[model samples]
Target: MFTEAQLYSPVTRTGDGDVTVHLSTEHPGVHDPAYRARRNAIAACALEYTSGAPTPRIAYTEAEEQVWRTVSIELARKHRGLASAEVLAAARRLALPTDHIPQLDEISAALTPLTGFRYVPAAGLVPLREFFGSFADRIFHSTQYIRHHSAPLYTPEPDAIHEIIGHATQLASPRFAAIYEAAGAAVARLRTDAALKFLADVFWFSLEFGVLREHGEIRCYGAGLLSSYGEIDEFRRAELRPLDVFAMGTGVYDITHYQPILFCAESMSEIEDVIGAFFESMDDETPLRARHLPTHANVPVAQ
Candidate 1:
């Protein structure tokens, strides 16, 4: 969730280089006549996060420290709640030194041993390809900051707590970790705009906002939705949807509001099964894609 527009705008180029859609974050704020006088022409919202738009870095405000502390402590405690076989238990093993707040440095020191990839502290969102490409190498694109507690059950944006405490802990499971890496590799190679959007759906619905089904019971798994107080109760026992045996269906998810529906997999092994299907479903031809496509390919670019 970025603070405002007029600093960085998402400008889409049409067939001949005409501006299509834009969520401007120009320096002038929204007071300029172009935005204020021509109010109806004002493009998107203040915290616009579209599939193709660049994910802006959100440097946590000075006021957010206390909230970060609250969430972190809770999740740290949550690591103990899961069964010894669960991913959270693995995260407990991966938990390294925290310097006041948990630094990416500390987290990586633990993760680097298991996987070649490390955590990268970022501002807002990384480009879609980079987000996946980093993962392709096992590197995790993480936001270095946390969301305030009052943030409507945690927005879909990957905040600091969401990354380090929420998602990184789950990364401890090698199989789940590999699925993340392979999925990133797939997204990196898919290259087309439509494919990237589909990857975003994977990240959103599964990695960030996914659930798991053990026996007949469903449980929260993904951090983006797990950090939420609003969603946890609804999805845990709810049907959500019958999960694809592979990571097939999470390719076109929606954010900016509560997810009315969720998707659940039976296990991490199931996650691998779905992702393996993703590989089989596509023919490799990513690099050939143009940087500036003439049309939307239904793939998402930025997270």
Candidate 2:
């Protein structure tokens, strides 16, 4: 998966409440003058926004709305059979608009009551510290831009669809929202970059692309897997291993394609007991603790 920062624009806020979001030209879609202007407009609107302030609405183009409808309709069907019950329940609670692109405010209205989580806008890449730390306050920094229209089903970076559809649904559940808050607390307590990176890796594997065994079948609970149209089907074919904290924190893998390896828990209760417990107890010593332990590929924890 892409590094956390690469998926969001870097945002800077001034003491006087002035905000500047610097969009990267690295993505070719951003090269379009019209798209760039739309992105900038949304970022500007976000700058003027404050907590409890009304979310700024973007006037989406017809092309963008069509993209939203296409992905929304297809992902809904795909999610029914593949997504975890937790994700499905949250999706029902959110009741996200399918016929048109939803404004960030609409998402916040649905999510805030359920889990105290709300969305904030980003231009391109949000710094890892601010990005993860915001979770402590139940805030999610998201990009307002849509993916390039040419390929609505795929985006090299996390777009509005990924951020809103994938993450917002996950955030809607109090159970999963608590994990996010715990992860944020973990980041706040860490003193070293390595420790933070380890946390990020753990999050990438578990929250972003994690899976769990439900009954006799393997199902996806991770946002990355839940939102993806293609990879969701391919994930079951990858190497599925038991959930291991050490392996997840230290594992190195390629992001240019579907993950060849994924960690799975026996059930949702196992997810809460094991992964949830890990998040609740982590501290500055976590890195040293992992390093001191034997190099085991996959250590089974009694679930």
Best by lDDT: 2
RMSD of each: 10.9, 3.6
- What C-alpha lDDT, on a 0 to 100 scale, does residue 13 get in candidate 1? 38
Candidate 2 regions off by >4 Å? 8-31, 48-52, 294-303
Q: TM-score of each candidate?
A: 0.64, 0.88
Query: How many Å off is the CA of 153 in candidate 2?
Result: 0.6
Give a tens-digit lDDT track for model 1, residues 1-303. Answer: 211122223444356534333324422323344433222221222124333344433333444556666655654554344222366656666763333455565677778777655776554545767766777778776655443334523443445666766667767767667767777667645746655655555556777667766555555667654455455545554335545422333233335455655666667677667644554344344212323324332322221
Q: Per-residue lDDT for 89-138 in model 2, tens only?
A: 99999899999988887888889999999887766676677888889999
Name model 1 segments beyond 4 Å from true: 1-65, 76-85, 96-99, 149-156, 245-254, 279-281, 284-303
lDDT of 2 at 183: 87
Q: What is the lDDT of residue 99 in candidate 1?
A: 31
Q: How well does candidate 2 match the true structure, expressed as C-alpha RMSD?
A: 3.6
Q: Which residue pairs does candidate 2 place in steric collision?
A: 8-124, 8-125, 8-126, 9-124, 9-125
